[model samples]
Target: MFELTKLVRPNILSLEPYRCARDDFKVGILLDANENTHGPALSELSETEKILELNRYPDPHQHELKQQIINFRNSKPNKYTETNLEIDNLCLGVGSDESIDMLLRCCCTPGKDKLLVCPPTYGMYGICATINDIEIVKVSLTIPNFQIDIDAILQKVTEDSNIKLLYLTSPGNPTGKLINVDSIVELLKQSYSKWNGLIVIDEAYIDFTAPNGSYSQSMSTLVNQYPNLVVLQTLSKSFGLAGIRLGITYSNKKLSKLLNSMKYPYNISSLTSNVALKATAKEGLAMMQNYVDKIVEQRSIVLKKILDLKYVGKNLGGEDANFILVEILDKNGNPSNEIASKLYNTLAVDNSVVVRFRGNELNCTGGLRISIGTEIENKEMLYKFEKVLNELNA
Candidate 1:
């Protein structure tokens, strides 16, 4: 057998993970973790709450949640078409965050193996890598467009650099721009030729994208074709179930098995599994789709207003998702963190509106990442932002 420590960092190999008090007691009143002191949301099977059974262990495999997700994707008209995927090919996690950690655990050897990320993106990927003691290699995406610099990524991969995971976000977070599908396909092909690395495509915002298309566009079909490809998604965003904390990963059987083997025995809680299953029900699926439809419609209106703003520079909308990232500038054409801070602090203080300040976060020094809110909320935000701009000028 190979020495696993040689591949990972010495600290991780020697490390002891955080041991919680709840970890020991198999069955007891779970008053420690701060669960909803009341109970889960009311539903049709309200009588079930009367029968409390906290003794039995949760399913180690979480079969019901996986099957429910599989069935919902098949039966519902979500972006992921039924015929293109199956139940055995998927694995469920506490959230895609867990999946990110699992992948690092399964693949990386702390100090020896490293991972890559395109930043001005998700913080979790890098954070997870660091916690696991995996070295981080940064590849910056092109500004304004937030497209992957394919060459820069390729340049970073060398014989000495044993890169294990490459994390990518389409219609990326903070910036909200989707890398073109062709570019993703090209990166995957190159990665395969260079090393046996995994390409993780985060599709958290996929459902909100334009109908029948994604930032990476029907790339799920590629799971069967590419051995190293993985897709991570969460139930939180579009499903209106952020509190539920469930994520799904789609990949080939080999990769799926590797991830499943490395994850915690009872990673998904029994209650969470139940909640996710109910949320994927026919009615729940329909409700999610309806919500997405409204968000998309509102996204367009917000995009137009941002474009019309004099201080905001060349802004683009919906190549796929609901969030819009616009480049903002001053009358002097300089990158203005002042404008972003002013909008965030002023609007939040004056109108109790919370908009994401992405300017310095992603090296996006002059822009704001606006999430698509309800129509009324969107109009109010636009008006507030306009007032801020006028005041700054005055």
Candidate 2:
């Protein structure tokens, strides 16, 4: 019942993809794709800048970059990472935003199809759906723990065959918690006759999780095994390479091929590919791990220190990601958006420290999503946050 060909848009399936010259050949005269053979137009350039070849078109397929990503992922000794995972299983995009948009366009036809999202998860899932003219179907994550409302999601999908994609974020954006794996597996089983579709798990914050110093929680391990699974990751978060704008998608080769076919011929730029290649290199991977370790340590310290304040209520999230979500308390000791918003503004404008006010999000009343910073940065935030909270409440 859950057929991929049935699931994808008919036009996307029938259409032919544009072929870039670099797709078949990368060397020689390269008199194709209309790329300027002359070196870059800049007069002054760094050694690395010249090597990047800004004058030419980048590899359309990004096979080498994809392979390097696999190498970085396989550094950890997992069965899937060790075997069966290859360049074919991965797809790279400008950012997860582009990947999200591409998936929306290729699978969910405008005005007819629906996309399911778990609330208090990533905002772009809904934003992209709206942009693509796809209906947004939201199912809120369970209260307090922030786990998926599995029974509700199952029923919704079963009743609605039009729902083509279900989006979930582990170590979510505002929620900062890991979704239950068992619950995910149960849905993927597709016991319901009416529905079973591609499940997109956004793991942008994955590298910062499992505070036990492991990335074992990543849903990527299940990608090769499940044809319906799509795991989205990025170098922007833990890798400190946000400027490079590389987002990764791990799925079965068939679906990967479909995505490749539908995407722009030259979606990944040479600048992004080269920088990402370096960031995912052996040395780069080690450096990223070191930074992740530091952030994890700092997250604990910041959470504990903030929780001590009378104006700060419970730490709502699972404490999994590089950030913490805590409720800003009112005079009566309940979550208060008014006070949180005031504090959020005060911190940004006056104190030179900024944290996201997620009070508008579901189940996140008075919530301030604070990213973990360095020792000095954290100290400044703690001091300024306490001052603002006390002033607002008074």
Candidate 3:
């Protein structure tokens, strides 16, 4: 065991994780997991027939799913090619969240080593780091707009800091602002030369930016050029497979091999693999493309409306992703929390609709992090928002 393992709480390191049937998904009597041998719910019978695969273990290597992803990327005219990197350079995980934990487990020494994060970003990064017993070094993103101050990040990384990882979320969660591609490439180049830390870019929202075609060129080319860079993408967002929980990480072969070796076997369920495999099918891909187009269009309208709103005014930033993050404040300079609470309460009265809130911790407090909903939902939101603003003004 590594030195870090010993430092982790005895309950944590040696603690036998809940051995749900889902946890130990390998060869077994199947009885241990207590899955209903009788079969799935009646409504899901059609899907059960489509998969036709329950008797045997899923492909431990996930060969079909890997090929489909490679094909999907290859079909893109803008994708990068690796002269030496093979499909072996990639590995599938339950979600990017799993890989996040796996990377910390493989690299950071618990209690002694640390990872760097720019917050008001993804909460998952912090959660995974804590569970692994890795100390978090939080360098808050520059205020107003949550763009990273690369200078501050670089300055903080020192010989004594034991910094092994740096996390950047593109079109960052809650903030919905993308860091410039040139800026990110520059950071990767400098960090690798000066420090031994890994630069991980979480591009979960990439598909949302496809129609705009901003980073499409620069991002793909730069990632392969930097050996220390690791890029994570997911099927959950644009692919509309959130329940399936498929995430892809693009990295150099050496790191890929290590991640593959450490991940628990069958971490992805056979059902998930099948759903993901089907998603890359002709009809499924078309559906995803259509959804992305609609989202991009709807996101634009929402941003404009938010900017036009009497209370929010011009403080809202131009969104480059499916969700828009705008600053909402009353004339009193109160944060958006009160207004968002009112909106949430109003929408949820029927118990059929709901809106999400990202508090002040993200620098967008008075702002609501509204996701682009269906056409009806968007219109309803506009009506509700207009009513709320009128009432507040009254």
Candidate 4:
């Protein structure tokens, strides 16, 4: 029911993307972009450093890397379907941040069209909207459980035709909740049909949900079914390649093609693409899942112990991600933001431990978001965190 062409901005649809030098050919003398033919300037380079493609402009389209991404995403198990997501169905960026920025520009007209984001959710969605000069509409997540309020979202979109993008996260940031498949399907049918806007789902922490491999929770599998649905993911969390700065977009050919058109000429560098390729390889995926297993196991131990502590209040959100969002207690065993703030500061400054204090966010009152770390790291964090909380309580 969603019409792709009608939703995109007129300027973006008609704009001719920058033609890069490497688009046509990668070999030969290649003087098109006016590059130095002598190669990299580093005279004394290591064996690994010497082979790095420093002098040459990286592949603008990155055909091999796209294929690798397609293979990796398609591997995530889905009972419904896995459409043949070809090269055109993928777009790579500096990070998911770049994709968010470009999506706002390509779809919404600044100062006119708007986007909707659930609060106590990821901050980047709003930040990107602000940067693009696009207005943002918010509908807070249902409390006691950080799930989307489907009816409210549907009503909001039905009333506002100018809302061009609706951003949601699976295993949501701060909340750490995975949106159910049924909820996504309902919103896609009702909200999308009425407004015909882009629904961007960020699934950065999906790997932790599954035991070791073949995670079936990814919304990427539904991309082919719902043309308007675009899933953004990154190697930063699951693959442990935050340094490579690779973010991926999976959607229908129309939306994916538009992202490719609007992105910078060489948005992904050679080093980034090379490292991402290696990370998404079969062996790399197995290793990533192994680490996921460890993290999940440690999360169980930490959550159980933390909740038993008299100073800790109710466990706030879902356990689908690598972090925990729980409240800090006052003397009467009530959730207290003041205590949470003090606990957050003391752990970082005094104990040499760091955890995010998400007390200000809606429904996250008195909450401290603690990340699941290595066995040794978690042990130390637990010892230091409990010790600090006790001191603050006393």
Candidate 5:
């Protein structure tokens, strides 16, 4: 019999995780785990505060929240009618961060296995690999367009069997481009079968690709067909529920169960589940769509206004995501990391306007990542940006 225990490190195999109080029983006094018996210290309980069962342990499975997510995904319109998913195919995490970490823990043996990632993408993928002591193989994305260097990725994975996971961010961070679905499909068909490794598509900004109830641009529907594929989504971006810290993973039933088994019990708190439930409902979905529409509209306005600035150069990405990555040019019309860093610091420290500086990232030599904000906020950001540029140039 091939046992999974052999894959786990000997130290982890011998270890016993701390058992929380709620692990024993959910009802009848719940004295097993050491919790505040007298209730949390609060002079007055609000409506939501009164409703939450802080005394009891949260549902380890989060069945109700999972159902809401399943329904929400199915509610979206895709080209194929068979895009429906069930609870078996879904799992919740503290955030996509947890899922990413757990996936490495479950599959990659520390110091023995490795993962592949395209550079100038999400930073967490590499950070998590480093934390786990897993080797990371970097294949930089093609410059200018910020698309995957498919040939290089295929070559690396084929040559190295230790590579167990591949992380790709659609609507990539810093670049703000959507990796084309065809390019991904080609990689899956041509390369994934050869290595038998998992491909994780991080769609944190997927909702910005289209309007609500529409997922034509998302690759989530392909999960059902591709056993090796895993799609990660979050309520943080378009849903506007970052505080609740809810992230979702869609994968094959077997892999989903394995991830669940390895994850800590009660990872999702009851308070978070309650808030997410309301947000996934019909009324909440409509409200989220309205906000997305306005953001998209403002994004166009911001893009145009930034391009008109004398110091701003070409926008680096496809502009599919909610943010814009614009190059900062020097007086000589060349990309200037020094000027970009200066402007980023000036805006954040003095003007109270915050944006990311990606001047050091690959292919983004002099880039500033500005997220789409409200109309007034966008105007203010541009004003501060121009002011800082003029001062520096003067």
Candidate 6:
């Protein structure tokens, strides 16, 4: 029998994680964890709230939420195959951040193993690597398209056998490019055969890409085909549940089991689970689709309008996600970080419309990441943006 205990680091094996007082004694004075003895700060409780068993710990496995997620994903038409996922194929985390950290902890030995990433992508992958004391190798996305540099990635992987995980963000953060399924397939094939490292595709913005009923664009449906591939989805974006802090990962049962084993027990609170259940219900899903439709419609209109402005240059990547990555141009028709910074600050500080300034990222100089907003809000944002640009040009 293979014992995972032998593979874990000496420090981690001996380390003790902090436990709450509830872990030991749930009754009596309950002074162990230093929680407030006076009860919650709320002066009143709703009828629904009064029914909650707050004194008891939440389910560590979160079986109810897991089944809901399975049903939701399986409800979509599987473009790759007719297969459906079981609860065993899914794992829940505090957020995608936790899943990222857990993967690093389980796969990468500190100071020895490395992870590969494409920059102008999500910042967390590298941040997590740094926090875990693991090495990060960068292979930047190709400019003009913001697609993965497949050959470059393969070269890096071949040279460094210690690379344990490769992070790829589809409909990439700040880039807004939806990496093609073919490119992902190629990378997965190469990584599995060459390095045997896990390929993690962060699909956080996937819901904004296609229409309500379509699963054609998501890579999650392909998880069964490739065991080495892991796809991450979150309720934060499309479901409008960011405050609930629920993120999900889909992969093979073996990997899912490993991740579950390494995670903290009772990671998901009962309240979060209850709300998430409602959100995944039939009515909630319909409502989410309606919201997605409106956002996508607004995004299209805003993209077209922004392109018409003289100071706005190329849309840096594919407009596949809820956000747009557009270049801020100078009067001479070239990228200008100075103009972008000024526009970002002016819109935020003066007009009270905030957008991200991403000029410092690789190949993203003079870029601003603008998330899709309500129709009226989008119009107002563009009005403020143009106003700021005019002032700068003046």
**Candidate achieving the largest lDDT:** 4
List the candidates ranked by TM-score, beginning with the highest: 4, 2, 5, 6, 3, 1
Evaluation by TM-score, superior candidate among 5 and 6: 5
lDDT of 2 by residue, 26-82 (tens): 788878768787788888988887888888877888888888888767655233333
The TM-score values for the models, in the order shown, are 0.82, 0.96, 0.82, 0.97, 0.91, 0.89
Candidate 1 lDDT for residue 24? 69
Tens digit per residue, CA lDDT, model 1, 1-394: 1122343344444545444445566456767655564555555334544343323445567666777776655443323233445665688888889988988887787777888998878889888988999899888888657799988887787454578778998768876666777788788778676756778899888777665433225355467666667888899888977887889998877567556655666677767777777788778888988998999888888888778987887663234576787766776866688877787788888878888777777667766778888999898889988878667756
Better of 1 and 6 by TM-score: 6
Clashing pairs in 4: none
Clashes of each: 9, 0, 2, 0, 1, 0
Q: Which segments of model 4 are wrong by more than 4 Å?
A: 211-215
Instruction: Quote model 4's TM-score.
Output: 0.97
Error (Å) of candidate 4 at residue 177 is 0.9
- Per-residue lDDT of candidate 6, residues 1-394 (tens digit): 1123443445555555545555576577665655555545567877655555554556677777788778877777446645778888888998899998988897789899998999988999989999999999999888778888889998998888788788999889988888877888888877676766788999998878765355657777667778878899899999999999999988878677777776787788878888898999888999998998998888889999999998899898677788898989988888999999999998999899999999999998899999999988998998889888977877
User: Which consecutive 10 residues in model 1 have the weakest lDDT in total?
Assistant: 1-10
Clashing pairs in 1: 7-109, 8-109, 8-110, 8-111, 9-110, 9-111, 171-177, 171-178, 209-320
* Model 5 pairs whose backbones collide: 21-33
RMSD values for the candidates in order, in angstroms, are 6.1, 1.8, 5.6, 1.5, 3.2, 3.9
For model 4, residues 207-264, the per-residue Cα lDDT tens digits are: 7774424457887777888887898989999788988888988889888888788999
Compared with the true structure, model 3 gives a TM-score of 0.82
How accurate locally, in lDDT, is each candidate?
0.72, 0.85, 0.70, 0.86, 0.83, 0.82
Cα deviation of 161, candidate 4, in Å: 0.5
Candidate 2 lDDT for residue 355: 94
Worst 10 residues of 4 by lDDT: 207-216
Pairwise TM-score winner, candidates 4 and 6: 4
Number of the top TM-score candidate: 4
What tens-digit string does per-residue lDDT give for candidate 5 at 1-394?
A: 1123443345555555555665567778667767776775788877887778576667788788888878877777445436578898888998899989987887788888998999788889989999999999999989878888888998898898788789999989988898887788778777645766888899999878854244566667667767777889999999999999988988878677777766788889889998898898888888988998898889889999999999999998767788999999998899999999999999999999999999899989899999999999999999989989978877
The lDDT ranking, best first, is 4, 2, 5, 6, 1, 3
For candidate 5, give the lDDT: 0.83
Two-way lDDT contest, 3 vs 6, winner: 6
